[model samples]
Target: MNDNNARRVVSVIVVNEASVLSRITDLFSGRGYNITSLTVAPIPESKYSRLTIVTSGSVRVIEQITKQLHKLIPVLRVYEHEDMVEKEMALIKFPISENLSDINTICEAYNGKIVNVGENVVIAMVSDEPKRIDNFLCAVKRYNPKEIVRSGAVALER
Candidate 1:
């Protein structure tokens, strides 16, 4: 990819209603824009949801996407974050035979803790910035994770 094609984050606020996500995603697909990560959740005590999308494109393409997003009927607002706080969560599972003390130490480094321990597995939960989360995943490779699930990025503009 060209250096001009940089990763960008866009946050969209929309009405909390059926088919809203479908319509929003269709706009990207119809235009052949690829979404690297997407996170959506309803705002508490309100009929609105925030969609956080991560994609790669040139500045021009991002401008176009922002313009198109504003055209959607249910969309309440759309903005590309210039200064924001971003985070992602990851859940990693390891074999029960792994050393608990070592695992806990590693988890603590990433703001993680043992959320569950079972007869056959140990599950850990970690939340941090996307890059830090990536580093955490890399560091935990020595433990041989049995499974891992990571949530998409969620961001708030400053």
Candidate 2:
């Protein structure tokens, strides 16, 4: 990707109602934009929901998105992450027969720890920077992770 076309995280607050998500997604698809990661959740006890979208585009394209999003009736606010605190969560399940001590040690190093241990599997939960989670996943291959899932980035301006 071009240096000028760096990835960006945008937080959009919109009315929690039908067709809002589809309309936002349509706007991106219609413009040939790509969303790398998208997460939507209701703002607790509120009439709005928050959407965190990760995408890459030129400065002009991003500006266009901001302007267009503002025109949407349901959209309340849009924020571009600039000097923001971002976090992502990941869960990995490892074979129970694997070395539990080693997995626990690795998890501890990354601000993670055992969340549950079933008869045949161990589940670990970790929350950290995106890169740290990626590194943890790489280190976890030795333990034979049966499955892994990662949440999309959720950021707040610090």
Candidate 3:
């Protein structure tokens, strides 16, 4: 994609209520915009939830999205993240035959550790920048992972 289509992160704070997520997603779908990743969770001690959305578009398109978000009744705030700290979590399961020590060391490097050891598998959890998590997945390929699940990016402005 061109620079105009560079990836963007948009954070939306909205009232916690049914259909809120559906409404937000519908807005993107209605506009033919694809959301690369989305993470949502209730804000502590409040009736609001924060939605972190990752997508790509021209500056104009992003601005349009922000404006549309503000028009949503439940949406209380919307902003495109500029300088932020973001992280994603991934869980990978490998056969027990893999070297445990090596897996432990690799996980440690990614701010993670082996979270569980099953009778036949070893499960590791890693939380790190999205790019670094991609690298970690590549680094562990030799172990023959059985399953992998990754979370959407969660971010906070710095």
Candidate 4:
């Protein structure tokens, strides 16, 4: 990409209705834009859903995406995160043979804890800034994680 193309985070608030996600995604796919990460969740007790999308594009392209999003009937608001707090969550499963104490220490250091202790594995969960989560994942590789699941970036403007 050129210097103008940079990673960006955007949030779309829309009415909680069926097929809304497909329409929004279709706008991206139809335009040939790539969504690097996407997270959708309902606003608590509200009839709205928040769609957080991460993508890479120039300012002009991003502006076009925002304008298109605004045109969608269900979409109420579209925001490009400039000043926001962003986070992500990850769940990691490690072999039971790993040192539980050492693992617990590492998890605690990263604001995580052993959430489950199965017969053959231990599960740990952490929610933090995306970069920190990436660091945590790298640091835990030594423990031989059996499986790992990660959530996409979520953000709220500050």
Model 2: per-residue Cα lDDT over 34-139, one tens digit each: 8988989999999999999988888888888988988899999999777888888899999999999889989998889989999999999988988798999999
Q: What TM-score fits each model?
A: 0.95, 0.94, 0.97, 0.94
Please write out the lDDT profile of model 1 over residues 69-97, one tens digit for every residue.
99999999997987899999999999989
Model 1 segments more than 4 A misplaced = none
lDDT string for model 4 (1-158, tens) is 34587888999999999999999999999999899899999999999999999998998899999999999999999999889999888999999999988888888877789999999999999888888988999998999999999899999999
Best by TM-score: 3
* Residue 147 lDDT, candidate 2, scale 0-100: 97
- Full candidate order by lDDT, most accurate first: 3, 4, 1, 2
Q: Where does candidate 4 have its weakest 10-residue lDDT segment? A: 1-10
Cα lDDT for residue 152, candidate 4 = 94
| Clash count in backbone of candidate 2 | 0
TM-score of 1: 0.95
lDDT of each: 0.92, 0.91, 0.95, 0.92
